[model samples]
Target: MRLQAEDGDEQAAIRAELEARAVAGTLQLDAILALSPAAPSSSEFDFLSALGPVQRQQALRRLLALLRNEEGLHVGDASRLADVSSPNFYRLRQLWRGRAKSGLGFLSGYAGRPTRQPRGVGALGTLGKLAAENSAFELADRSIRGLSKLIQEEQSARIPAYTLDAAARHLRQNARNMPDVLAARYGFRILIDYCAVSLVASGSDGSLKLVEIAWVIEETTQLILAARPVLDVGGCVGQQRATRAARWYIGRCGLDVPGPPAAWIKAVVPDPVSPLDRHHVDRMVSVAGEEHVATTGARRFGRLVTDVIGPILGRIKIIPRATLSENTSAANVRAFGRDILDHQSIRARVAQSVIAHNRPIIDMLRDSRLPLLDAGDRTGTMTSTLNDLLLRKG
Candidate 1:
């Protein structure tokens, strides 16, 4: 019978042809049995496709032997048809009998390789919990040897480095298994950090350009509020541009000068600060209030840039290189930045990437039962205060 073209729906076609052949008394079972076991019918081929070659051949041979027996063939004749010795035929028959009693369980592929009940499953579970509770960036940065050593120290047992690596990979694949951020007393803090990212223009003479990116992250929620690309028209990021960006963001949040900052603003800037840069920091203080604005250490700051901000940007291909080199040209940087801003679709794409990255973290935060301040609630307070100040001016 000709097999139907559609997969998984050819059973009816096969059955109809078999019944028609049987009614016409033209169904030669012996001739069908004589066909090579290596080449199977469509249905049998589909069933054995997933099995290894040896297992597939063995399954077909056993099936042929069963069919011969059903035809009332003697054991010796069935053994000859199956191309097996008499003793081996009896052994196969015994195995098949047990499997048939279990409803043809032998067709489910190899019965070898006892079920994969992992040893030390409890230890692996604990390892996963430990890896998740710690920073994913930190865990990923650790060397396999280092991770193995740490695991041994923590668990007080010698576990293969490969095992620890697999556990870490599993944790990363399942984000929900990771630990949640602790809820802060005052809403969420925004951690602002600057990093240089490499980008190559889309042209024949496309050369690498180092673009500065400013990452604004909410602390308690662990959500990225913004990832604005800093445009340096003068070939280098200056205090004026950085400060202007900072001031604009703070103002947009409706925080007034000489008033309590809506969110704690901490910037991680480069070491050996210039007087002009110090002036920028002073300006941020005036806007965000003295207690809120502070600079983090260069080393700790570098970790945040490389581990967190760098990876997120890398995933979207916005940054060509994962880490920018020291000698990256600052020339024509503003042109690229201007291009990004002028193109509304490009801006929207970047915004979408930020939103996608934040969704999982937001869900995790919500699952933790942490109280999140509503955006409307915060905005209403700022708007009312600004209106009162405006009325006073009138």
Candidate 2:
């Protein structure tokens, strides 16, 4: 019995050691969890970029074939035909499926080891809309340099964890104090902040109602997961709304979801400046779908607010979606929707305001750069060239 007891203790020690390694990310899980590509089409693959010119083109073809024949594919035959190992074929297939983009990017000839990818600036794209929104109007006093610096700070804080290893390491370092919620990986970091919203009309008539805004954004896709406006004001409820939206976002399978978002969380970053605190961080982790909260360190709270969600939602023209809580019915919301949200004039004006930032931004120079634009009226290429550009980088 003593020997058995000793063996049991030894096994527990080994298991604990393994989990610790997993938390620190010494154990590689072949990186199955990654940012889901936000759209249907994609162009570049980092791995494919490493392949030789000929092999690169071949890889695309192989990936395309695998996608086409996923159901009836004889793994051995497919790999032999593609002249790649079974494991390689599987890996390619996994990557293609995970990104969920139609495997369609044709290789270009100018391949002298891409000098550098263009700087992808998603924050700057939303600049105009942000400037117009009351929620972010504080920037009116700041200089361009300050604005740029602030955007950089927000981006650094909201960077997506692409692999399980990256997520583990990030949570370990940043959230070590909050051991109760340490196991959870966030799809978005939510922030409980304030916004200047109009209670009577969607239109700004000089004065506006100030309400607590839940600025929740999925770092990976750089997309606002929920369309709803938050009516609640406290830390716990605001986080619940944000994470609940994230839960809905993650739970939703795209036309056909391949797997899950890397790290799978809808967490809110805490702000010392804002009245909202981290009281709800634990529940935020739980509802986002993790069972165990680590009991190691004090909960980590107090950080900068990422500025992506509020401005984007503000610029949507029509209020997207919101039902923060049943108890807080927000009679103002009802009147606001009826008076402005559902109005014919507002609906008609949507097309004009919809893609406020979708105007194509093409640049031209000498041999240093070549610029081109091939677009018809009302079809802005900004979404393809800019919106997805940053997401693809992530």
User: What lDDT does the true structure give each of the candidates?
Assistant: 0.44, 0.32
- Listed in order, each prediction's TM-score against the native is 0.39, 0.26
Encode model 1's per-residue lDDT on 1-394: one tens digit a residue: 4333233446445434533543344443333343334333444233343333454455555565566565576898778655578997786777666642332324333322111223443456566666657775565445444555565666756676546554443333233233442422223345656665433222224443444455655433435555555443321133334333434433454322233335455555443255655555555556556665445443333344333332333123333232244333444343223232222323333444554455555555556654433433333322232222121221
Instruction: Name the regions of candidate 1 deviating beyond 4 angstroms.
Output: 1-124, 128-181, 201-208, 232-265, 270-278, 284-302, 307-349, 364-370, 379-394
lDDT tens digits by residue: candidate 2, 186-290: 221322222322222222444322233443333322234332333334534554455454334433422112222223333333332332344344443443443
lDDT of 2: 0.32
The runs of at least 3 residues in candidate 2 whose Cα sits more than 4 Å from the true structure, single-residue gaps closed, are: 1-208, 232-235, 253-279, 282-306, 309-394
Query: Judged by lDDT, which candidate is best?
Result: 1
Quote the lDDT for 362 in model 1. 52
Q: Listing every candidate in turn, what is its Cα RMSD in Å to the true structure after a full C-alpha superposition?
A: 18.7, 24.8
**Cα lDDT over the full model 1:** 0.44
